[model samples]
Target: MYSEKLKYYEFFAGVGMARAGLGGDWQCLFANDSDQLKRQSYSDNWAGEAFDSRDVAEVETTDLDGVADLAWASFPCQDLSQAGSKAGIGEADGTSVTRSGAVWPFLRIIRGLAEEGRHPALLALENVVGLLSANSGNDFRSLCGALNEIGYRFGAIVADASHFVPQSRPRVFIVAIRREVSIPAALRTELPQSPWHPQTLLRAHAGLSVEDMAAWVWWSPGAPPPQKDFELEDIVDLSDDADWNSEEATQRLIGMMSELQLNRLAAAKAEARLMIGSLYLRMRPNGDDRNVQRAEIAFGATLGCLRTPKGGASRPRIIVVEGERVRTRLLTVAEAARLMGLEEDFVLPETYHECFRLIGDGVVPAVVRFLADRLLEPLAKHAKEGVFTTINGRKLA
Candidate 1:
């Protein structure tokens, strides 16, 4: 049966997180990405592989030889990310395009596939939250419009890694299925505005009203039960040989903190037992035209979003508040992997920086699994049965 064994193609396939999440039932027919380091990591973790290390813009549809049931794209978030320039999809010199503008090439490939009669049954896109507001929502609108043009109906939701792990990584996922497949009317109705159905998404695109979205589902499989017992300590590696920052370096980091941050640190220090805190250095406005580094600290059971440490300011620091003393260290690559729902058996590069970057840029496997279980698996089952189905009681067929 077509749906019994779903085959998928992955674009921007970083470290195979989406593949991991889809689990064993789904087969990845083809995977493509431009980054060699990431491809190396992908090859290391999943042996007996042939990854297409080509730029998405240059990859032709013919290169994808087989028919796939699903297509997953975790495209680069550099342009749409809040941490980077808000350069929404900028136009480049007549022909070539910028990095963020790579989404167009992705669409082009989809169109090419459709033209060749090889379009996938379902499509999934993953990216940062900033895409919703990029260019005051025009970018997202264009994206949805393109999918609509290509004979697919899509639903979007913002899933946070904290629901399944200890990190606070929140990302937006867009799931699209071919229009021919009948989706019941109940699943397409408007839902109450919440995390998954944020007001921003509803208000971002013009003509995207609740009533008009007969195909747009507010995909929520119910939130994971409150993890009151979970804590950051649960994921921390306490090996004796774990790398800890030197005393001098730790003092320097503390000294760089502003008075407000210092006060927060002092409060954590006052605790009787050791407390765990996460630190990030942000670029804040200093005066009129310049920006200054400000050390921000959060004392909570969960860590802040794990970001790629490209620069000194982007790296996240881990702080251990023990009574009156504080120890500081860079978050280990192993810890970052754990936060992203990667098992310990997952392979890593010898260089610490590369491992951290790969994890930071990749998706959380647990969140992907949640999406697959709730959205993809059910859709596959319905397709296999060749039945018109409604997610809710509302019927369309």
Candidate 2:
């Protein structure tokens, strides 16, 4: 094994979801978050005492002198968020200079490492899509400038959880390698070329500038995963004796539906009772074929991006019903853990609200595994090949 285990430090460690995604293949050496409750939750799941509830900006590099190989930070994205106030800009020290400059504190960690000549070999960052356009590119430019100053080479990609699971959460991931190490020229060249070079509109109100736009590269959607023709039969979780009477639910659903949709539901309900032994909510995705996946089950299909504010519980879980005797409930958190490729045994928080909130704000474990197996592994191997021995050994001062 190149490493018996890769060691990592997790910043903004929310309930240790990233650690859950990585599994036990790697060891977490240091983790920090400001939330006392989240810190306790992180401790409950992982075997470590490194959970420090401190403002990350206040964390000094000397405090983490010989800790880990990689550093992961899923910083707060509210300032650059599309759904929230698009506050931008922070002071040089990274305190939100404006009402919405949360990213600065995140960047400050890297800046501090650069000053101390103790930056990690690998840095993985996650954020919202709005970051691509925040502050007319000033925020991003400053970030790039910081990394450049610290001798790091960075690349970014936007991936949706739906690629691996059924959730369509598109997030921006920025991966960086210490500059002394040789980044695979081939890897850079092989990245899918993008044609959708849209200017990121950070604020609905901000002026457009030439450099504020990011050229988005497109990847051919991967092969669709196999699916069973099992309708609601395979996953429904109602008790054997549970009653299905919900006139109020029916009425409310009807009330919420548009007139056209209400008509369809009424017709479908009536048609099923008259003709078939079973009533099914038949659904299919756009341009779907019999050979294609059952693209119609709204819940199983790609879910919309999970938002921090609109937690998993706030949303109604979806259910697919086929007949008087068949129905599948929206995925439970345990099932969601499986889709995220998390270990079934991983402990979750007891608080219902916290559990959903943490999951919503988490990095998909599969995504982290991909970064570890596909990206970080290669970088680590290349570094061990003596690509940056001189660079790595030099002190920043």
Best candidate according to lDDT: 1
lDDT of 1 by residue, 255-313 (tens): 77888899998889777676887887788887889988877889886888887664233
lDDT value for candidate 2? 0.56
Weakest 10 consecutive residues of candidate 1 by summed lDDT:
388-397
Where does model 1 exceed 4 Å of error? 1-3, 91-96, 184-189, 205-215, 238-241, 311-313, 387-397
Enumerate residue pairs that collide in model 1. Answer: none
Q: Candidate 1 — what's its lDDT?
A: 0.77
Model 1: how far residue 56 lies from native, Å: 1.2
Taking all chains together, each candidate's TM-score versus the true structure is 0.89, 0.73
Local distance difference test, per candidate? Answer: 0.77, 0.56
